[model samples]
Target: MTALALSHPAVALLLPLALLPLLRTSATPQAYPSLEPLGGDPLSAVFSWLLRLAGTVAIAALILGIGGLHLKGQTITKTGEGAHIVLLIDRSSSMDNNFAGRAPAGGEESKSAAARRLIKDFILAREHDLVGVAAFSTSPMHVLPLTDHKPALLAAVDAMDRPGLAFTNVGRGLALSLDIHERDTSAAARAILLVSDGAAVIDRKVQETLRAAFAKRKMNLYWLFLRTAGTRGISEAPPEGEPDTPQAFPERHLDLFFKTLGTNYKAFEAENSAAVAEAIAEISKLERNPITYVENTPRSDLTGYAYGLALLCMLLLALAKAAEVRIPRGSPA
Candidate 1:
């Protein structure tokens, strides 16, 4: 089952629910026999059984009290309306490749830098949508959780520092984004926008598992492939393999990988800053589908139940103490 994602407003309202336990009383006092079994010659075992039953009820109450405390700490509720879009960015060492566009000093812009710019523009365009960022290299890393704070999310985008390794794990980033979106049950269509220049080098079994997981959520996967835009001077284009029928871009395996995304997926060839921004904006449009059903917020009034339990437990302990305190005087005849 998919986990529900709680909005900020819902979290704020339920945050206090965690502290209700500390405010209530401990336990109720037991009635002292009006006249202590005076001159009583065995009132029968019936009274003893009655006392045991009362003690059991009190113990149950204590169990209830402990449950109340547990409920408060992990309260989750659904709030706000609209679809959630998570941007899963690849921040492995390959993202640092300085080959998109170069300056006269022989230095070029990195793929991640381009991705950051595109994401910032996209966030500015649609600040209403709840969006998050996850940057991954060898493992998935959350740059920002789902939120409406555009500025903060953008900062997360900016914070995707390139790892020193020379490879990227595309699947890891995708899996993490899906996990986040699944938690937010209010989202209508959980969509992921992944920008990467290379395929994941992880094992095929792992990749298949990741693919199955994504399919289960029916997630919309969008891809923005960044490649060299053919600078007027540099001639070392990553070997095109004897130009097949003179196509604009030769049929690389990357095309097939993206084609697997099918209809919901839109593959955009963005080798420069402007195209990257356009592709992101286009995907944002698709991610804006309205949410149909909003789950009823969990009505956690377990506070009262908790207090009752504590009272019950205290009563039991008190009874036990009283039993220990009773001094036997040979039947008060």
Candidate 2:
């Protein structure tokens, strides 16, 4: 239930003025020989009391209106088909290149640009999802907290395509994303949407921490690998002569690490914008689960309603006055 509040509590001090109508009579003074003749006039008594009541209501309502009545803001829990998603975006310098691994020219779109466009669309399509955004290059940067606010989410997605740093620090980025999820206590379907064009070897200690974190929380992990031409894919084996190590084959090793985390993990290798869109659509389809999210309602003003009641009461009083019969001093009672 919404709670009632007043903007100016001092104005409520005038509420006692409403009692004046009951204490004092509004009828004009008239001279009469005796009160015995009107002793059984119950109908007239009822009408008289009704007018006083109307006056009291008008005064009280006006006072409340002046006091600025309103309903306090409230947060409500709502159930819907959505997930708590953290968009872990890559902001490496190489992300600015196209799928062919060159700077965007003519109609070609950079990997970051395509990711931004598709992710924004994905966010809009999931109306009830609680989304947070984080970007990582040299370090993980928390862009936005988990929220259902669409405008802020769109703004965060728009900022992802900005010029990026030199390194792709995926370990710290995943840790930050896990921390974001940890801060939220909502019991909803949780997922991490990792968008990156390249991979970096995570430190051994950081990898242990990530493994522990992933084990503690059962979450869906999605890696949207924007693969450039002639580059290694997540599942591609190293060349016959090359050693198969994390340093030599980071993407494949990262995929192997995610699989070992024992969570629902999937990797999508998109070579262009269309492929990225298709992958996003698939992820959107997989993350559909019943979720209970919090929705906040802002404070609502009730001053106008109070004033409207006062006006209604005044109109009743006006009608009563118009219907009243005036008896002259010398006229028969």
Q: Top lDDT: which candidate number?
A: 2
Local accuracy of candidate 2 as per-residue lDDT tens digits, 16-125: 99999998756666675778866778898898898899899999999988999999889898888889999999999999998999999999898999999999999999
For each candidate in the order shown, give its overall lDDT on alpha carbons. 0.60, 0.92
Candidate 2 has a TM-score of 0.87
The superposed Cα distance between candidate 1 and the true structure at residue 49, in angstroms, equals 55
Using TM-score as the measure, the top candidate is 2
Worst lDDT run of 10 residues, candidate 2, spans: 24-33
Tell me the lDDT of candidate 1: 0.60
Inter-residue clash pairs, candidate 1: 4-183, 5-183, 5-184, 58-312, 61-309, 62-309, 62-313
* TM-score of candidate 1 on Cα atoms, chains taken together: 0.53
Candidate 1 lDDT over residue span 1-333, tens digit each: 333232222333444443433343223344455655465546534544444554454544444444343322333344433467788777766666644443213454677776777678877876357787887777788777878777798778777644545556666677688788877866366677777765544446755766677667777777777655663211224455754321323324334444554436667767677777778777866676655533434544454664675576556656655665444555464
The positional error of residue 258 in candidate 1, measured at the CA in angstroms, is 4.3
Per-prediction backbone clash count: 7, 0
